[model samples]
Target: MARTPVLAAGGIVLRREAPPRFAIVRLRKRNEWVLPKGKLDDGETPRDAAEREVLEETGHDVEVHEFLGTLVYDSGGRSKVVHYWRMDAGGKPVRALMSDIREVDWLPLDEALDRLSRGYERVFLENVGPIALQAAANAERERRTRLRVAAAERRRAQPAEQEPAAGAPVIAGARAADPAPVRPAVTPEYAAADAGEVAGREHVVEVTAPEAPPSSAREIAPIAAVVQPTPRKNLIERVRDWLRRAA
Candidate 1:
């Protein structure tokens, strides 16, 4: 005789948080903490049964997202097969009224893992835990991306009005039609300094005075350099001229 499989369904109900949390309830028959589940009603689907059982046992509305596959075990000389899913405890919080449950509460993943007595239940958590955490991470990444896009759009929509720093070099912004010229800071010393120009042929302007030519030499030619004329008389001659004038 072929043994018939017992159909049951449940979920790993996840409350969205940093690491996420799971719901655990105590069974009245065994008095052990287990994920909330119940047997399938006649002609009911596994997904429906899982959602229905989760709500009925935990008294919280749940949204079933992904089917987490099934686990088969031996119970009372028959195969008790249960289908599980990854469900979200979505939206705002509400008061959870217990139905067909004893002492139900939310627990951290590690605590929930320790509370589950069955190896199959632990296996389900190990599989679904990473999935739930990864989902939360993806949601956060999408949210940040949306914020960045919004910021960029806002920048594009607003007009640019940034003032240049004080005493900084600025290019003229007005067009040829406007003709508004901004004056630059031009110090006197900077304008007169060497001008950085190349020299013309045959002549150079000397920056300093040169020695006077000897008194014996007369009628000199134009030199290669243009120089300031030195005082023709000696200091002793100038002193004697002043003395004679005083007398």
Candidate 2:
């Protein structure tokens, strides 16, 4: 009869760096460097167990993501099964090392693989390391993209300044000059019409000689005598005058 496999869970915790690093722990009793993991507690789900175990072993808080893969191996006379999930650790450890862990070290994939005392773990990291790093890189890119979009939105939200009208004065150190007073322009025809209207309103005055002042004194001088008319000469005289002329 086949025996039931001993079930365990753990994390492949990654710390973000220039080239990312993976977490591995040294065992207290066996004195071997291995992936941080432990067997499941009674009634605990595999995912929760994976998070708890990683925290206890690595002494760093982690955010767990996708499931990596399973490792099936032999321990004593029983088959062992360990499930793993990809996780991200912060920059610094938040707690002390767990009693079962002598120390925890973060290393690059190749070095982490070589550092593991178990062959199965080395092979597992070899397969899953690229996947975890890629996921981290993709997430970082998405974060930067969101930040850029948010900045663009903030720029759009601000009010735009109104541009001054063309030909308007731009003063350097004082308020803009008040606009020049505008005069209504008139055509020559209108100016001529206005002049005619003013000329038409002029008045013409007629001055008669003033009446002679009343005579201050009564008239005293008599009128001069009129000359008498000449009398006609008698006919005889007229004849004698003619005879004389003849003689």
Candidate 3:
């Protein structure tokens, strides 16, 4: 069986500030600050592999912003391509594990350039650094724009009041400004529909008369006593009585 190409991934180490910064991890044996990366597993894309590798190596979760570039170099006569990305790590860098990563640190833009391996520095400066700077600039511009718009709205709502001069317009245009009109209070009739009383007070159309009290025993007629006839004893007794009468 032919050996499969080793797919790997990792991330740019980040420095947190008003505008974030990027750096790389220093592997123990290699002893170089390079972008955190590892090989992809079966069915894993390079992007997913990169994110996982960065988190594993750096202990920093990051949002991948964009693909920076790719590195294609020969490894043992087989070509390997390492995909790079610009990411936002969202906070301070902390060293989590010591086995794979010896130490993790945040370097300023210029200092990061000094620390990264010469082989990868070209990629960092040419691709990743510029992209990160542009993103930071864009974020700053958006922040300033939002602040300006909010300040303008505040000023418009409540402009500074001027001291009244002897001949200055008496009301300062304040009274002339119309107050927001108050809506009239709703009456019970208008609200009655929502209350399920649309038929207006459910008028008792059929006023049934109250039932009379049950009659007392004194007012009721007495029940007559019931007399039951005595039953004859047997057929023999009946026949004897009939014969005697006949005789």
Candidate 4:
């Protein structure tokens, strides 16, 4: 019987960082250290094969995120093509070796490119590195942005500072720079519709506070009649939140 041309699938499994590193494996019999890839099993898709091979070879679970490209090369007289994907390893490689995988290493992309035994693979990384680096920078920026936003939210979510005791004397201009407390978060759907923007575009809210009804149109309630807000629960609520997140 005539042998078929080779078909394979693999991944550039990353353990996410500033520069992004990839998982590499070495075979016990072979002196080469290369990406973890293998021929697909019967009835398997390229994505499934890639995920499965990485787990089997490196003992690490991963989810494929981006498709890199396909590489075609010759092995003996047969033509072989391997599809590559950019995968998130979820965590560090556990070195869970099956019968085939000998040693696994996580290396910086640039270093991995040089350490990889195949020129074709190195070239692939060279071409993909710039795009990947930009993505990493963007992700890092977004993460920091989220942390800042979360802090802002926590501050906003807090109840306004407690009023002084009923009999306490007011000091003129105490904490005057503290802005008035914000009311509520805008619903995402409203925000989305307000901007009518494509993905990655932000909605600029143009809130025109209803023209201050001339003083004559306003109801002047007695200052003492204003309902005082209740004091909010303190660290206990935060502890509950921390416990919830931990769970």
Clashing pairs in 3: 7-40, 8-38, 8-39, 9-37, 9-38, 10-36, 10-37, 13-23
Question: For model 1, what is the C-alpha lDDT against the true structure?
Answer: 0.71
Tens-place lDDT digits, model 1, residues 189-234:
1121122332222223333333664232221312233233323445
Query: Candidate 1 regions off by >4 Å?
Result: 91-99, 143-247
In angstroms, the error of model 3 at 74 is 2.1
Per-model TM-score, in order, reads: 0.55, 0.67, 0.52, 0.59
* Error of model 2, residue 199, in angstroms: 23
Q: Put down candidate 4 lDDT per residue, 191-232, tens digits, no spaces.
A: 221222332334333323334542421222112222233343
**Which residue segments of model 4 deviate by more than 4 Å?**
1-4, 17-19, 164-247
Candidate 1 clashes: the total is 0
- Evaluated at residue 31, the lDDT of candidate 2 is 96
Most accurate candidate by TM-score: 2
Model 3: per-residue Cα lDDT over 10-108, one tens digit each: 666455574456656788997877767788888999899888788777777778866767776666767667877766674754547548888776767
Q: For each candidate, what is the lDDT?
A: 0.71, 0.79, 0.64, 0.72
Query: What's the C-alpha lDDT at position 142 in model 4?
Result: 96
